[model samples]
Target: MAADTAKVDPMHQFAIEPLFGSDWTFAGHNIAFTNSALWMLIAGICLWIFMIGGMKREVVPGRWQMAVETMTGFIDDLLEANMGKEGRKYVPYVFTLFMFILFANLLGLIPLPLAMAGVHAFTFTSHFTVTGVLAIMTFAIVLTVGFWKHGLHFFSLFVPHGTPPLMIPLIFVIELISFLFRPFSLGLRLFVAMMSGHVLLEVLSSFVIDAANAGPGYGVLIGGPSFILMIAICALELLVAGIQAYVFALLTSLYINDAEHLH
Candidate 1:
């Protein structure tokens, strides 16, 4: 029972551990190198390697070049559809954001590398702090672009174009409140999604282990079903990973569109 209890801590996977000694600090603050930071570095390195493949500029596109170009073109089309011609300038930011999240999410589902090292892979996106920062960064860009492009006129976004004069005030209040919730919602959506999926996987896996330890009969019943369900969830998680990344970039482009052409 105690051993089973230890294996079932789903939240433990999200805990950040300092790779360096715990005593490492800066200016009386604990700034030790952490597992989350290390994973981010790994994701960045992987992205760099993947992206450099397209830079060779081969006259005939190879597998790597074609794959990279397809992803780039996909983002370009998404932004253009959302924001029109002006969206071209944003391709780099949106593409990077999409790829980074995709890589992080996908890597988190693959624990083999870390398992070999006797540790689980860290998924930074599971932390609200990381996702919140990303959401705020996107929100900041929207604000900067809105005010920069349209000046004080950007405030008109709170009032819909066809709103009646009398309804304008009421609608404005609601819209402004909704606008303020963007960052929180964006951060929360990603954090909760990543965290929930992991927790579910962990709990189900514990059940499988407990059943197996009980006896062969229990293992054939509870353990088999649990193991099968884990496999299915793992496959579903891969789809969710890509979808979440695309949703983040899509909403970002849409928000930027609102800023660029306020209606």
Candidate 2:
């Protein structure tokens, strides 16, 4: 039993296995409906239902309606606080980002009997590739909006307004590097946080399972504390899921502000 626990692979949760028929290769590219892709699609659908289905005009809002309104207002306030009036135009993009991430993060916590059924549960955002793509999309938007609005003047963003002429070149190089690293940093932050938390949970769960297999006495002695800690960690992860989503959206809004105002 102890040996089995030792062999438990916490990182296995992040594997992107094919969801349909055996993995296929087309034109030297592997195209398969992976668990990651499925989870992403599920998250998108859930978000659509939450936002679109809740759009019923009522004089007295129900719980679901209130939840939808509160979420909308929260994102609206987030954009307005960061980008002022100009941020209004980006509500759709930012809101979509927030909903996708929030739902993905939350969905990952749902424990299904996948192993018993020869399947596996996965968290799309736990993979760096997914988060990296999201970060790149946000970065691309920033660049497009910046260049479109400022033309060649977008390059001027790398130079501080009050920099000494002699130091301008050095500052520009530093700023350029900083700008280029945004996607990596943003993606890594989310991936590491989600991955690490899930890994810890898996490890604790393994301990609980091992204790139960050993005996009722051992289960009471060991599994009890492990189970309590698991619950606490789960609650914390739920809070983190929401916070990381908000942070990602808030940072995007700030980046948009930088592009628009060049400050």
Candidate 3:
């Protein structure tokens, strides 16, 4: 029960711990080495190691090559299923984003400050900043592709080709609103899901510890239920982490396709 009583402030726990203390500030913002940035670097390293090292033209791939090929095939399938043949062109960006987010989410599970996933501070995954930055980059890529493919006609995206003149203004307003919200919605979706999952885990684990020492029989009874719930939540979080990463990248690809196709 004493251990349970050491309840970390939920808000405080979310705060980003500086990677190098106060020595890394840039302007007014806390420019400290963040847990999120650390994970980003780790993700980059993992991507290089897996993709670069696994490249092989052999008839029978080495084990590492096979693993990389399997993942690449999976991403290819996902793109084909969702975005069609044109999706192939965007594979490089999609694969990079997937690996980065997937590694960020998974590695955060390890016991290191760099493993902070949903931390609130300046860290990437915890706050919306990291997600926001990624969202903007994705948005730029999508918008660029669209405009490049269609030229000035890209503005026509908001102006449906066959709409009656009377309904044009209304539809245009709606489209504009959606376009503006794209980055915010994308960033918020990932950040909120990850943060919520971590909070639930922490809260439940605390309850389980508290329940385990209340009394002999009652503690056993209470702790049993609490422990089961914690396990369930942890499993759910694992699923959410992977699914959310996929979702973020998928939407990014879709958004880019939309800009390109005007649909």
Query: How high is the CA lDDT of each candidate model?
Result: 0.90, 0.88, 0.75
**How well is each residue in 63-182 modelled by candidate 1, as lDDT tens digits?**
999999999999999999999999999999999999999999988888565563558888999999999999999999999999999999999999987899999989999999999999
Candidate 2 lDDT score at position 228: 99
Poorest lDDT segment (10 consecutive residues) of candidate 1:
1-10
- lDDT tens string, model 2, 83-113? 8899899998999998899999999988777
C-alpha positional error of residue 72 in candidate 1 after TM-score superposition, expressed in Å: 0.9
Question: Candidate 3 regions off by >4 Å?
Answer: 1-5, 25-30, 111-123
Error of 3 at 46 (Å): 3.2
Model 2: which ten-residue window has the lowest total lDDT? 1-10
lDDT tens digits by residue: candidate 3, 1-263:
56555554445556665566567666766676665566677777867887875667678888888888887787888788778898898888888888788777766554345424533322257578788888989988877888888998887788877999999999989988899899999999988987887777667666665665555676578767877887888778778879988999889878977876786
User: TM-score of every model?
Assistant: 0.95, 0.92, 0.85
TM-score of 1: 0.95
Best by lDDT: 1
Candidate 3's TM-score:
0.85
Q: Rank all candidate structures by their lDDT, best first, as comma-separated numbers.
A: 1, 2, 3
Better of 1 and 3 by lDDT: 1
What's the ranking of the predictions by TM-score, best on top? 1, 2, 3
